[model samples]
Target: MAIDLEIWWLRCLSFIIVIPFLGPHLVAIWKMLKDLLFFMVIIAIVMIGYGVASRSMVYYPTVNNFTTEAGGSIDNSFDGRSVFRQIIYPVYYFLYGDFSDELANLDSNPDAGWSIADHVLLAVHMLFVNILLFNLLIAMFTKRYEKVHQETRTIWHSQQYLFTREYFTRSPFLPPISLIYDIYCLIRMFVFFIRRNYFETPVYQHTRVFKIIPKKRDTIKEWHNFEDAYTYEYAHDEVKALKTASMKSKSGSDSDNKDDTTTDDNDLNNTTNGLKQVQRSLTRLERIVEELNVQLEGAIEKKQNPTTP
Candidate 1:
């Protein structure tokens, strides 16, 4: 039963591996944590200072009365163990509006001067922590959230690429099967070492586990090329259809009344200008495609007729 429970916990924890795929907003949360760490340091400094001052003020009269006498040991309240309980914790809780306990016996102290000073100090501490520092932290978080929101799509793509690359570079099999694959790789490496052909194999070509498998880079490039070609063809067809429709509209408008001829001519001029801009853009795209094709052809030729080294 315990072993089954442990396995179930492990299965649940495994879902953490897919957290990056869940959303890009996690990046913002990470940034907020970093900001919070720095903020905590500042809060710690403020809390420690206030805590020590307040605790000392409260204990000063008691310590003074004890020191006035001879041969009596001071109480354990002044020891290190009491510092966190008496000072630090109270100040920390005070920040969250739990000040009633601290204020309840404030006026009961014998020294009016020390009690007044403690009150003033607590008021100042509250203003700094509740008003100033907390607001500043909120502003910092808001700025970081906005920045991450603006680039959410780009961040998501980068995260997906990293996740894909991580899995792609690892063994396709899991656990026991992966162990077998590792043994096979070790045997393959040993054979290459014995044959003294290890250094001669290119780093990229060394990962060819199967003889008939194509390179990942080549497959990705082919996919990208196909997508680009399809996009270009679709754009070209849409532009041609738009131009035809515009020309037909202009012709139909020309056959209408002469009073509206001026307005129609103005519309025709705008349409022509827009078409000209699109044509110029298409021409530039065609030039870029031609250059890429030329480069690809030269590369193919070089690969086919390699120069002897």
Candidate 2:
């Protein structure tokens, strides 16, 4: 089959132009569909299983037998041999909070009434379908919706960038001009690719703002050397300051010690002065005692030699 290049080209152009506007909404829809697909798979499997179980165990024997006995063929209309009618519809009804009429009929009729197994099966089905699966699907959809809604701006901007890039690369909307422009672009790209280094280098080196910035070419060893140099300088200054402080402290302590020694010498001189004063007082008292003894001796001499009186 011959392909319509024009149709495809127009579609591509339209997609590029329109998608930027509706990107977020379209993305949200897509995400919702994806989440719902998984949710649906789980629900379908569980529902189908219950449906098959109920049909085989409960319906086939009771409803089918009843229809057969009521002047009907073996393949009765009420038999519900189709999976859609039997399993899907029943599960759908159960999930949507409409208790099945067939179940109600079976419950009312004592002959075709639910047995213990049937009751248990219905209870379990209701628990999963009505209580669990339904709520889970709602929660999953709500979470996905909120996520898509929250990230709408980011998604839209990213998609806009892509669209704008495509639009610029492509030709104008006019057929003749667009074709000419496309051909030109194609030739330009081919030439650019062939001589990539020649064309690309100038654009990259001169036109690009990012390329103007200097890139660091330091190796691990160089980085380590820089760190070591910084650390050594810092440590050297710190050690110099510490040594100066230590020397100052030593000089101050030596001066304090000299002052202490001077104070001790003064205290010793005062003690020596006090001792000399006590010695002088003792010497004067001894002289007085000696003088009194001399006077008594003279009196005794006078008594013995009394002829002059």
Candidate 3:
């Protein structure tokens, strides 16, 4: 009853954890599909054992054990065997007949008929499953142990004595094998200096090599206002000054034209008035000269009469 209850509890508990994490864990396992194949084969063996075990424990758990891929009908189960034989003894009997004499009591079963062939198959399955299990465990855990051990050894050896590398150079016509190490050192030094020079150069001066982004603090104010560059450079004050200068030049030209027109009109009026006065004075002089000529003729006649007397 305790075993049965435990089995039921484990089945239920697996769902509680597995239902949530099963997908991710399965993805992880699926990524390493080759490794998972070994686990799959072992699981298949365990499931087969379980099915036969169920037949013995509970009556007639489904008897379908044929796999299409393996292309062989596995003599998967037998009846009338003891509890140990139905569950576990068949596995040992198949793997090592070394256990056949030890667990012979398990062979007397009420199946189609228990045969030597069936025992050998069960033993082979068990051996394969066990080997798979051992190898998988080593692969998953062995590397971790090796890494820790290696680090400890390195520390111990490094503490005992300092390693002094004596570097030498090679020239042309020399055996390269003797100078391979020196060449490697030179290559490493070249790479180091190149990297150092690249990083130490000012990023602003060599913008093509690398772009230097201004910090958030520098860009934040400009971004918030979003000022137009053209608007800032060409202000209202500058435009207004240009317009005022243009208007003043036009006004000056108009004033000069008006003054010249007024002077021409004044000159024409003075010339017309002076021509009228000169005509009136010439007529008056003509009248005075006619009167003087008449007086002179009268005096000449009187003088001729006085001379005859």
Candidate 4:
């Protein structure tokens, strides 16, 4: 009994192990299956119609050839007793390039009651199933894959959140012991329900308002961080642009040294001073932005979670 229990537990664990790996991809797989279901409906209609028609064409021809014992060899691939083997399987297999035998039978016994209609039907069936329907299915799959690829990161994060919440909320105990935890929860819920309905002031009637406030604060902090980073990048780009302009001015001044060397030297000094001033202004602006960010964060913290006294 212990061995049996162990085997069962192991199997359960194996299944559980696959959840994390398959969780993110489950949505994409579901979408693909939905598309495939629609495609299958169309395929079913076409296959059944063609199968019945093809089978009817060959049904009398094969029967007569069999009884008369004609010199031509019989094609039994689509001459089975059951509808499945005679029609459905033959047509389905034909989609996968199994047409040589059927074609050969037609060629070898041209006078065996086979006509242009049979050949035309076979051509039409292959054109629809192999070329049209199959390609359409492939295109549908590709479109679904592209959509899933675009949202892969979002899907992964959502799946991770669900996994995290599941593990955090679930009982820590395994299997048999977890059943005990479940019963404990059931009783707690029943008691809580009774208290809430019967008592004026239920002990478990605490609001979840406090829990949500912290999440709001965290979101605000993230936005503030993003703003600060953007400000810094903009300042950095401005500084780079000023430096490039200064370099170009200095190069131009150097190139014009033939006409008034003294003037070129003075112009270079002016450009250098202008660049230094721009850098200082940028540094001061960055300092102000940082100070403002700190003050804003402090104000938000005070507003969200004010000190009791």
Candidate 5:
């Protein structure tokens, strides 16, 4: 709740810099998702190389009901080898193509609860290698990703809407503290988006970003001022229609009462003046009540927290 305004401004400025172009952020996320699949693929490739080098490469071994070919029975054991092959590829990349797939061939039958912690420093080994493998993959993707990022940045930087529009008016009148909190949170999200903008294609850039041009806003008066367009007769027609509906609702024999009950000019004027007075009185009363409530709460608190109560 104790928001620092300085931090808020910093965040706002950062968001302007980071998310001004969303193409990069989108691309980064896409690349990350794409890389997830390749993470396994690259690992498998390395594992195969390791198996070949170590002379431990066996037939693309099937287990767990899997045949060497697809569309075969699900040998529970063959399923196990499929899992091994899965693990083997990534492991090869991590081991610098040094370790064999022998570990994957540890047992024809899986341990009741399978894990590799028994004989090898599995966690440490996996952590170090996965870091390098993932780093290399991300680096490669990011390089390609940044090319698209520059184009987005250039496009957005040239776009005048970023500055022309009041970027801070989403709430119109939220307190400085609240805006600060919002800016801080949004800056991080925008940073994430900035990373995405890098990977989007040119087609994506034109189609999505082009439509974001600011639409002209109609002023309140422009919308609410129907006096010129709607004549006094047009307005009076509504009142007459209501009366006619009321007459229909009553017995047809009593329809004469509807014309007699038609509102006169004096009655309409008085009603309008009375409504205005009531609105003014209500506004004044609301302020007074609010002030009284605050004072009452303060007095109660003072009594509760007196020095020698």
Candidate 6:
């Protein structure tokens, strides 16, 4: 059976294009996550330094006992003996590393008094991880999120438009049947290209998927009317009318002042300065209006011949 296959072929191409763009969007999100990993590395370096220092000074000390006044020594082996067990384990616990184990051991050492070094290291860790790294991560995420959103927003919208158009225009409902229909469409499209000279065939122009289809002639006419009304010449005429109205009002006021015979020299000077100021302002406005008209005309020309670029 002969069927129109152009729409299906175009949809296929659109789907291919849109699906690959999703990968870039995912990559952008992954790129933003790198900052978080970098932040973690910084904290890990600090933790490693503290671990090494405390392990060297406290854990593997030359004298493993404290001397007392009675000429006896007391054993100082209450803390951990290894760097992993002493420094790393304690820091991990504070940072919620081993959640189940930490929860289980929460009540086991609640009454234990921390060493002076332990207190100082804890403060440093808190300042870096909780205060500095946390805020930096939030700022990095916000910045990256906006950048990624801006980059991918157009692609995402295009994908959505294609999806909606394809779904609404699809003929077959069931997946297996739809697959068969798609295959038939592809075959028909191949035959169509075979019938026509490949190089001589008309180039396909892709219509914007998101462009709203005008259902009524009246609506299209209305759009045409709007375009005509906002043309550069029409806008220029409107500005000119406003300028003429302003000039007429100024002349009328001047004539009224002339009729008043008691007008003083100071009043005349003030009126002259005010008229000069108004003239300057009007000239500035005219220049601005002229610039706007030029820009509008250039925009219209560019829009008319979009393929020039």
Best by lDDT: 1
Indicate whether candidate 4 or candidate 6 has the larger lDDT: 4
The TM-score ranking, best first, is 1, 4, 2, 6, 5, 3
Q: In model 3, which regions exceed 4 Å deviation?
A: 1-102, 106-113, 148-309
Question: Model 2: per-residue lDDT, tens digit, 70-127?
Answer: 6653333555466576667867777767874756655665554444567778889888
| Per-model CA lDDT versus the true structure | 0.74, 0.64, 0.47, 0.71, 0.51, 0.59
Query: Candidate 1, residue 291: CA error in Å?
Result: 16
Structural similarity to truth (TM-score) of each candidate: 0.53, 0.43, 0.21, 0.51, 0.24, 0.33
RMSD value for candidate 2: 39.6
lDDT, candidate 1, equals 0.74
| Clash count per candidate | 0, 0, 7, 0, 34, 0
| Candidates 1 and 4 compared by TM-score, better number | 1
Per-residue CA lDDT of model 6 for 67-150, tens digit only, reads: 533555333445656546666765655554333443243334344333445446556766777778778888998888778777
* lDDT (tens digit, per residue) of candidate 5 on 90-186: 4555455444544564444345122233224444556545687768877877775676566776645544444434453344446886788777768
Which runs of model 2 end up more than 4 angstroms from their true locations?
1-25, 62-64, 67-81, 110-116, 162-309
Candidates 1 and 6: which is better by TM-score? 1
Candidate 1 global Cα RMSD: 15.4
| Worst ten in a row by lDDT for model 2 | 205-214
Candidate 2 residue pairs in clash (backbone atoms < 3 Å): none
Score residue 145 of candidate 2 by CA lDDT.
76
Model 6, residue 296: displacement in angstroms? Answer: 34
lDDT, candidate 3, 1-309, per-residue tens: 999999998555323323333423332333356555666676656746743643333232243333434555333444656545555564443433344432343354425233344455555555655676657656754554454344554433332222111111223335666487667768866776776687774333221222223344346345323433333334444445545654555455555777755654554455445444444544464455445434644554565456653
- Please say which candidate is ahead in lDDT: 4 or 5: 4
Q: Order the candidates by lDDT, highest first.
A: 1, 4, 2, 6, 5, 3
